[model samples]
Target: MKRHASFLGLCCLLIVAALLGGCASLPAPRPVPPTYAIQDVASTRLARIAKQNALPGAAELSGFRLLPEAPFSFNARIALASRAEKSIDAQYYELRNDGVGRQLLRELRDASLRGVRVRLLVDDLYMSDADELFSSLAAYPNVEVRLFNPLPARSGSLLSRIVFSIHEFGRINHRMHNKLFIVDNSFSVSGGRNIADEYFMQDGQANFIDMDVLASGPVVREQSAAFDIYWNSEQVRPIGQVASFDLSPEQAQRRFDQWVGGAGHGLPENERDALGRTSVAHQLDDGKLDQFHAKAQVLVDDPAKIMRGRMEERFQGSVSQRTLAVLETARSHLFITSPYYVPGQVGLAQIQRQLQGGVKIIVVTNSLAATDEPLVYAGYARYRKEILKLGVVIYELSPMLSQRSGRLGEFGKTTGRLHGKTAVIDDKRVFVGSMNLDGRSASLNTEIGLVIDSPEIAADINRIISIDRYTSAYLVRIGATGGVEWVEQDSSGTTTAVHEDEPETSWFIKSKNWLLSPFVAEELL
Candidate 1:
């Protein structure tokens, strides 16, 4: 009977493979109607407000504001969309159909209703069972939805999709991980965030401590250029080209209304007002936008990076590669905040050189217990001792942090994880964006970031985070036996408890790590 069952299973698998191979082939890339960002916005409200408050003689430069709060960051995008006069170009790696995601779509719908052109480009890797919503969104008069790196098998299990599209594995594996939002080609926002409940601190199960920058002025033009590249890339496809939609325009409006318009999880008038960027809009209205004035340079991975061969990828002007080049110029101190920091041999060599040159390096990352990607921690653990021996300071966020609802937000039953990616150099420059120090960010995925030359902004960011002294993170150190130890500190920055193992890490997970760490490669994590 066991033999019969095995044979039957094999037969079923073969049958499914044959069926999928026959029907799941992706359609050939169709000609995408080219669209470019509108650049004649010098007279627009955002452009005028941004210029009014630009750095004294640096009015021609860009301006930026750090958004560390979840509620404010979420609302800032909404506010910009609400105030959008001409066009809104929003791009992200992932945009779920959850509560907050739906609300954001609703805002876009409203913006379109007011005659604003809307273009939403989202990655298709995790977009399963969302054809109806996106197709419906595209049905609106002024809205267009496109997918980045879309898959052939749209409606099936993730495993089935991968299996059916195995022939194109190399292409499908590469993804566009850039995130940006622009209004009227003037005001923009970018960082390591996607449209989801967890990112906004609304997910009671768990949440990430993240950061975003609200950018305006000259640098926004560069950002819009990056968006235009991906929007018109061959990897992107109009929603109608990938999936079939039966919803009429009227039906589309009804569908959107049902999803976000007055229901459970719907924002009440008062709450919506609180969530909206009325204050930001008011500041713009008054031409008194509070932001740091800085000369900023934008870096974006060329959209064609994913389509190139291995050797060609290394020279694709990738954001991670360029960011590393900037880090090499660090004179005194380098403060890095990345959650999944699996610095491979190349990165370690860079760190060694920096330390030998008398540069101080500090890293803030997630502990095994607090991280959403537990397996990724295994890659970091392999280099923890070596990193500590090189005189680098390390801090791992503690799980105890979730007990209270503070700046990191209420993780509730789960732990707060670090998701922000930024680095400060000599307290005079700041690099903020979606690029992580991990292997995947280096080559597998595309990313974007900003390099700002402004001591005031760097100092302010450092004072609030990274090296604030008072933090809910454990000081990682090498023990006398050369093993790792996590020193838990008090509010006054005194060591109150010492953990011989990864604090709050379960024994089962430890065993799993022991088995899996050896097989894990630094670059892949």
Candidate 2:
């Protein structure tokens, strides 16, 4: 009996081990497919200027506002403008419920009730619990909400899952990450902030940050046109309308009722109360809004319709065409703030040329500790050496550092994440919206921005964001040995070089990059 029992015990242990091992061995997700096509140099240049002068001065020079580096000062500068009152209201809010999200939700609800048309665009990556909120928002007569790309549905019945799996496998990875909120075509909010708790810093753990610049001018008209294009495009679709599972009009109505009735009050643990704030809460009430009597421009790009019919002529060359032009026109300095930084050989060349020509090129991006996507960082890391070599000043945001701690400034105790995409050049122009300096923003994802030609606004942006905050960010410096060191000053006033423990980034992460590199082309970043 003892011998038989021992054999059975051994067999059970082996079975358990196999089961756990199999679970652990599940393959990492496959990367999204290549989405950018290489284009001819000439064609690339044309596309850059395609949106140039579209709204006059839209091609102004622009710079970036990287975290642990700068707070958005452009908004404040506009707030300070004393020009002819154009009735342009301005507001600044943090990521927590105290600022943007709640304010946006309230405006949306009020607009709906008053029958003013409301349209919202959000990057699908952050749509964790927004589905219900969106569905509710869609119920109003003046409101129409669409999702960029939605998750594949699991069929209600066991048989249904099997039925749909064969046909629906490709819809999982690609998503719409464009973030824009347009109000009646007179005002719009565009930047890095998405409709999510992290973007709002309501998550408590991670300071999900991002910046959005609210603008009203002839530029808002362009933003409206851009929003209409995406809304009507096939890349986005109305929510809850997908056939399957459980969403019903009644259910949607119930959600709407709860959201509107309890507006501004209750939200899930990970969500912000977007509905509590009133109209333009952050800005001065009844104060005269800023006017953009100066030249302003707008640029919009997307992959939905392949203009010129050649895949190569599409999104891959979009930003380069425009950005290169902006650089060439820049006089004194240029600022760049992108969450993901992966300027390929060709793109980096232009930037290098600009730096050598005596243009003050400054870049603010996330450090490894602050970067949410490590693989993207892996690709960006490879270019650091080449970029810094060109004499461009680079600042990588430090993890958990506040804006006040150093140059970046003090961050809200629980809210801090730099999610702004901006560029300013020579105080003559500024670009702010949802485009990153990666392949994705270039070709795969649709993006939009405004080029403001107000030197006053530009100076304000530089002061609040660039000058004050960059001190806390890791300054990228090269040593004589060609070894690049991430330099940062600690509380003791000592500078140190940061290196990882593994000396090898985790094998798991490397393997992911290796497998995804082929398909994870930069244009679609």
Candidate 3:
């Protein structure tokens, strides 16, 4: 009887170990303190400065410039953080502890040391690895870091967190997808680029073709206000309260210094020199960086979007709604570029209606070989044939495009993937922001973007697209037999047929997509 009992005990222990290893058990929620508002601190400080200097009001026209090159975009962000005299505000969806992430953290820490109040808000879904870093940054008196929609168990593997929070998945899955960086409350950068090596062309394995707009006018005020809304929302929790860590200010400073000194040390000398040469701040100071004046409006989703059922009531004035409204007004042409393009039946119908009304529609999105999210691509693939039937033109970015053809010339041997989310209507209005044309973006996530009323900017974007799309992408069309075939253009402007959805994609990827498509829910993709 004793031997039998020992065997049973061993079996039970093995079962428990298996469960924990596979993330099959749910984790208990921990207690947290109540959240309070931080107020619009950055804007208030900027208002005082503007009044003292006799500057224009926050509602006046603003200056806007596009940062299409990744190196310049990264440099602009560093310059903003370095030059911030009073306050800095930033919010992002994902921030890794890799190359770009470390550099930004060091810059923010240095800015804090110089007496600049740095406030950062990041989505907590991907914060499992960065909890310690955030806690260390929060140790500084001048720095504050918050995580939006934090999980019940703050530290764990990604699968474990998902399984443990499975019951609350509906709420936890809704993330804040806004990417905004404001300095001194008077200048801001808002668009699709997150804080990562891929977004900034630093990752040699894969680089994202992204876009950002640097604004220094009335639009910055609106962006600042949106940041305040999310910063003060009850859904945001301080990183210190969520994760337990005890790092002294001195220790934090030492870590930051090491990170800063070691950053880019592995890069070749030419890449580093290229990065140093495209400094927008230096050009602006020397009266070389050109800018465009425009009337711009910042649109953001309600902070209550983090709430599951309450999101519908607040969806009326959301960024998605405003974007659809703008699309409805398009009469001549509509140009759209989204990395993840999963427009459901309703969106397709809307596009069909526009097509019937004689409007030309052109869309550029990631091909299966280039997309980082194959599941999302599966969801998008369901609509390709239906969209083609409506006479709309579609282009998928090539995964094997040469690095020399990339917007950032410094991207060495990196595979290019489309990450910019933009739309142009009738060459009169332009939309650039974090919103993707997918159901998740429309109903599940909170997004922010800018609508600029400037024909000059619109024309510039139209011209770029007209020139680049044919060279860097595969044009999808209906074949003679009524099936899809990809067409490509060679360097000599010679066009040829490539008869596959993604000719360059590996068989493993194709098989994975084929197997996963049946199980993936379109709304969740």
Give lDDT per model, in order: 0.78, 0.50, 0.74
TM-score of each: 0.91, 0.68, 0.86
What is the TM-score (0 to 1) of candidate 1?
0.91
lDDT of 3 by residue, 1-525 (tens): 000112112222433444653333223334554332233444454434333332346346677777777767877888777777778888998877788887888788888889888889998777766777777777776888988888765667654565555545556768888999988876688899998888877787888887788887667777877888888787787777667655677787565566456665222223322223435566544534445677888889987865747535545667887898887789989999998898787688899899999999999998888788877878898999989889989998886653545533455677788888899999999999999988778877789999998887787676656567877888898888888888887645468557655767888988977886776566566
Q: Give the least accurate 10-residue stretch of model 3, judged by summed lDDT.
A: 1-10
Evaluate model 3: give its lDDT.
Answer: 0.74
Q: Candidate 1, overall lDDT? A: 0.78
Top candidate by lDDT = 1
For model 1, what is the error of residue 44's alpha carbon versus the real structure, in angstroms, after optimal superposition? Answer: 2.8
Ranking by TM-score: 1, 3, 2
Between candidates 1 and 2, the one scoring higher on lDDT is: 1
- Shift in Å, residue 110, candidate 2: 3.9
lDDT of 3 at 64: 73
Q: Where does candidate 1 stray beyond 4 Å?
A: 1-23, 157-160, 263-279, 467-470
Shift in Å, residue 169, candidate 2:
6.7
Candidate 3 stretches greater than 4 Å from native? 1-59, 255-261, 264-278, 287-289, 310-315, 402-404, 407-410, 490-494
Candidate order by decreasing lDDT: 1, 3, 2
Instruction: Estimate the TM-score for candidate 3.
Output: 0.86
Relative to the unseen true structure, what is the C-alpha lDDT of residue 292 in candidate 2, on a scale of 0 to 100? 36
